[model samples]
Target: MKNKSGGHRRSKSARNEAAAGNKNGRRRRNKSARHGATADDGDRLSKLPNDLLLNILERVDTLDAIRTCILSKQMLNLPTMLSQFFLSAGSIPGHHDKACLFSCSEVFRTNNAVARVTDNILCTRNPKIAITKLKIRFILMPHDSLTIAKSVARAMATQKVGAAEFEIRTEKDYEDCSPADLLQFAKQLNNFVGACWDTFAGLTRLWLCNMRFGELDIPNILSTCKLLESLHLTNCDSGTDSVLQVKHAQLVELQVDYGEFDRIELTCLPKLQRVIYNYWCTYEDPLYFGFVPQLSKLNLTKTGIRSEKILELSQLLANVPSLSDLHLDFESEKIWVIPECPKLLTPVLSKLQHVNLENLPEGCDLAWTMFFLEAAPFLKELCITVWDHWCIMATDPEFRKKYGFCQKADVNWKPHVPDFKHKNLVKLTINGFQPDDGFMEYIRNILEHAVNITEISLYDRKVCGSCGELAPEIKDKVCPSRYPQTDEERKQITEGLGLASRAMVHFRS
Candidate 1:
């Protein structure tokens, strides 16, 4: 060897030593040494096995993943391993702060990483199991206007990605965002969008809207997401052609707010339990609206509809045997003259225990109570809002204002023979109770007849308009019985009533 070359001839160890290269090569050599094997040892130790790696990632949240990326150079690409990525923000990053905190650029990169992970995991020649749940939550200031769609599509890839839950919540002032983004997302995934109807193969929940949308689009979305168990759609617009046909049998809860719909039919869902429609503009009744028998709770507030619609809804709602809670509040500055709310007797309300009828017309309390009693015969609690007795006496022109006394007409008189033979009655609360014969009689009847009664509350207005005078008769005297004991109690009650009266005036105006 010395004769052949001027330099020393390369030996096996020398060649091996020369081959030992950068940090990665040195680490490989070290790993082999640690295992007590040859440098060419095929058996390699993995930081995490395939299954275990996926399992560990399944437990780690998105923030923790980002934290992990900073842990070591080895974890630099670990974000690509996760099928689900969540970016949660508490408050919108202000202008001075980094807009990149939740900027479109960051989301774009994150979404690209998510896509790569899906392709690697799901499209592998021998693809492993796909992720079942992908949840992306944006809770703070107006979600980056463009964040939702990219997140949704990354969740809805056709070949392998399964069920996904997307939640985007923002304050009411993010007006710059458009509804087209949502519509475009749905339209893009129209094929995968039918996941809800396929039983266990679809989306479980979808909460969309801090913006407005047409009604037709919403029902289509609902129909596609038939397997959806809980759905919340707010500030959406619907058209006459738009029909809400809930065809899924697995839906449990639905909340639709400030929308308009032409026909809402629910034949596909058999397991639906609750529905809340607030400030909606729809007047169309579902073809077989009340045929379902398993629903439990319903709230329809400020839904501009004819009296006949309420009666129809009530009749339909009565068929459900499991309903227990009901709230229907329709109030306005202009008088709403509608047929009396129908007496509901569905098995659904058989166990109803609590009811709240707020902002009802003044003289409707007795009739409202009667309607409530007929529907929820088993009711144990009720709340009614009306003007204060003292306020009426002082403010009503019909009354000789100055003292706490009001004429019958000034009181919005509704003659009623108060009786509580129902026996199930336990607690009673009357707001705006002033010292008047009608008011006194109402209170006395509840205390006298409710044998099971234990607690009774009477709140009076802060300003007593009745000049503290009576009609001067034994039968009509209001101060004869059951009054608060101290000035403090009286003042507290009066203050509460006064505040409540002011609140009503504010609400009504």
Candidate 2:
């Protein structure tokens, strides 16, 4: 009986050992599963090819792209491969907090973050890689500007960047901030350009806005950018300067909008094919164009015109012998006065083809309209938009003082008829057409002169809030026009104008 009891105790001990072993095995399996998950999550992005990764980064903002560098060991050097860098303070993550109370501290924090990311990428970029473009938009803080200038200089010193665009803007809260900061930023920019003069020689495009510089700096800066093809200056100024002259051989396109300069002279831009000039300020100095033989398109929007000046338009167009497309917006001002000398009215724009005139005041003599018809014998299309009362009231006071309200000139002061008819004119479009004697006479002159006219379009001034500024909430509620036209009026205009049989007429209200 004692031997049997010993054997049973040994079996019980064996069972206990078996239970412990099973528990240990289960623990080991659970640990393995946890580790497998972590390994699977380990830096899958690192598997992508470097070129593919760089392309992906290019589509994202530069701030986000730089932040990816810290993701893993493989991504540490990825930002160095970027060919294009675009940094904007407003685009930084977490910069736009949805809270109603946006504090100054948040602005500072956002600006600091932008500076840190930009400096890191620019400083660590591969010197051998050629950066094709670098664009930066940020507020003009004094210390930040200096830091940015230094960073740019360092990057330019190491890399072969082809184009650089800088946009200095004011913060939303500081829109009306003092000009002192802008002045300081401009000084830093001048210094940077001077230090990196040779590096900018291969630059193809340059754009700057809301900066101030001296008159002498303008020429100096352009002289270095010998290969620049396009230049745009908006709301820029030269301190205490009246004239800004741009002379470049390789420049193909130039735009100057709302710049605080009295006069602008374009002298040696032989390859310049397009020019856009728009300024609303009152200035009497004329724009002098010289040697621009390839100028094909000229757009003038709300440009100040001097009615007292003689042959102003003629002098401006004399140099652009190849001009084909012309767009002019008088901005509801009547400055097209008859020139004193008939010879001065003659401009041989033989190659001109398309003309677009907008915001022409009502009841004014058609002499200004006739000037181009007689000048461009090969013109193919002419579009005119008549001004409404709202547009007339919005005209600047200086413009109104210089050129009084629109009125027909004395009956004795009729424009001279062209020696040659408009044989090539094909299309005529008159928007906001009114049934007045002056307008009818204008149409009659065109019908009699344009032998090859094919189509005429007359559109009554519809109630159009599209042309005027309306509040977003009330835009849908407001009626477009107070007076709706009847179909009978349309028929009367068609019959009164004696629509030419060769031309098809389309009338719409």
Candidate 3:
């Protein structure tokens, strides 16, 4: 407690030293204040509770959450304390180019910054690290192979694994997997959760991209995931003859993209609601496909099925009393099969609120409309994508003869509104619009008949930029006034805007 100078004898020099000390202290204080004001300020953050901060972090991606650590010392530990594990490699900061790097490449690099952070989280303690959702995206790079495999394994081990969505895309030259590699992949599913045991028992939803499994291997995977609710498989290397026997009663939605199926059987799936099958142009099938009682919607697009079989299948669907929405597309050139068309198969569908048909021959208008007249009595909406050139031909008798041979002047071919009065029909859409005399006559008849029709859409063919610039010429060709009387009525008819408004309409198909 003794002073450096004699207590009573302190001189001016001592006072000067005291003043310098005060100045030095103030300088240090101001320097800290300046730096803390911008980068190290923690006063405002103290307002939020730990729980509230965690909530905010949960909504963002893991990369952004980790960046919060730079905020202050308090935040440094908060990122690691998080219970929900998020493993998205693409969205990390400072790597904007790699943000959407999942597509268009084959070797993912694992030595990146995001992977290091992920490894830390995987290896950390704090047993609260429960992963509810796992999303992995890769470009199929060789360097990323080990990283992806390891990350996936870690996620499966620590997480509850509510959903595991894998998106793997490779270049066109990528070879299909050998049978041994696929089997090994399947076997690893068991190690994810020992109880799963090659069965995704806990997985309610599964999505795979660019995967390949043999014909015999598919059923094995399906049987394991008994509770699967949604299954989507796209561009898999599996052969078309692969028999997919899915009998899960809990499966509600199934979508197969461009696949070959030797035989697809569904013995039981009482809860199944929707199925979409997209086939390549080379596929040929007269085989019968079955469905569950609860099935409601079915879409068959671009399949190389014979036209006759399409009619048979349509008739077959009448048996599914609960079915409400059906979409069937056929190649324009295929000959249509006219089986003994059954009376609208189900009274439930007879009361159908909406119906949609596309790509059928314009000359087969009677056959096309007749199906609607019989099947959808309560139809409230109708859409037709007519090929204008055919619809515009001047009374082609041969055309009518070829399509059931009904004469244009024949009573049976007359446009009858009463037959499909459908008092409920409120909206009509006709795409691929062209204003030829024949088309004008058809429009006049449709407008006059569909009294309840409130709105009709008229859209031209989708043209490229060059063609779009030539739209004036194209319009002149299609809209020329061959018959002034008919053209005037058609124009006046659409004045209500209910006849020619350009709006996209969607109906049950």
Candidate 1 on 1-509: residue-level lDDT in tens? Answer: 75466877877765776687557657888887997787453333234565565456567666656565555565555555666545443233221232345565455445444433333433332224355566654432222323344434443554355556655443322344445644443343343333323421356777655533444555566666656788776654443346666666667887876544554566656788888877644444433444456676777666232332333445455456676776665442112222233233535456777766544433333333444444455778765544323212233344333332223322122223345355666666655444445554554545454456555555442233342543444224333333455666555543543333222211110
How do all models score by TM-score? 0.51, 0.66, 0.59
lDDT per model, in order? 0.49, 0.68, 0.52
Q: Which segments of model 3 are wrong by more than 4 Å?
A: 1-107, 110-132, 138-161, 168-199, 237-240, 280-291, 303-311, 315-319, 328-370, 383-418, 435-452, 458-509
Instruction: Point out where model 1 deviates above 4 Å.
Output: 1-86, 89-134, 138-164, 168-201, 210-226, 283-291, 303-313, 316-318, 329-348, 358-367, 384-420, 428-450, 455-509
Off by over 4 Å in 2: 1-135, 142-164, 170-185, 195-202, 280-283, 303-311, 336-348, 389-415, 418-420, 435-440, 458-492, 500-503, 507-509
- The digit string of per-residue lDDT tens for model 2 on 306-366 reads 4433225666677767888988876655444233233553453678899998867555665
- In model 3, the worst 10-residue window by lDDT is 406-415
Candidate 3 lDDT over residue span 1-509, tens digit each = 34767456557776786667877757877888877765545465644788888788767776677777566677777776675545454522222342445542222332244456566665663546565655544433344434545655565666545555444333222134455544444344323323433325545666554445666455666676666788776654355466667677688988776644654566567788887766532333422346587887776655222322334445445445576666654333332333233243435465455555554443444233444544565667766654423222323456544544322221133323344454556776665555454455655555555567666565554333333344353446443322223545445545533444423222111
Name every residue pair that clashes in candidate 2: 463-480, 463-481
| Clashes per candidate, residues 3 or more apart or on different chains | 21, 2, 11
Best by TM-score: 2
Cα-lDDT of candidate 3 = 0.52
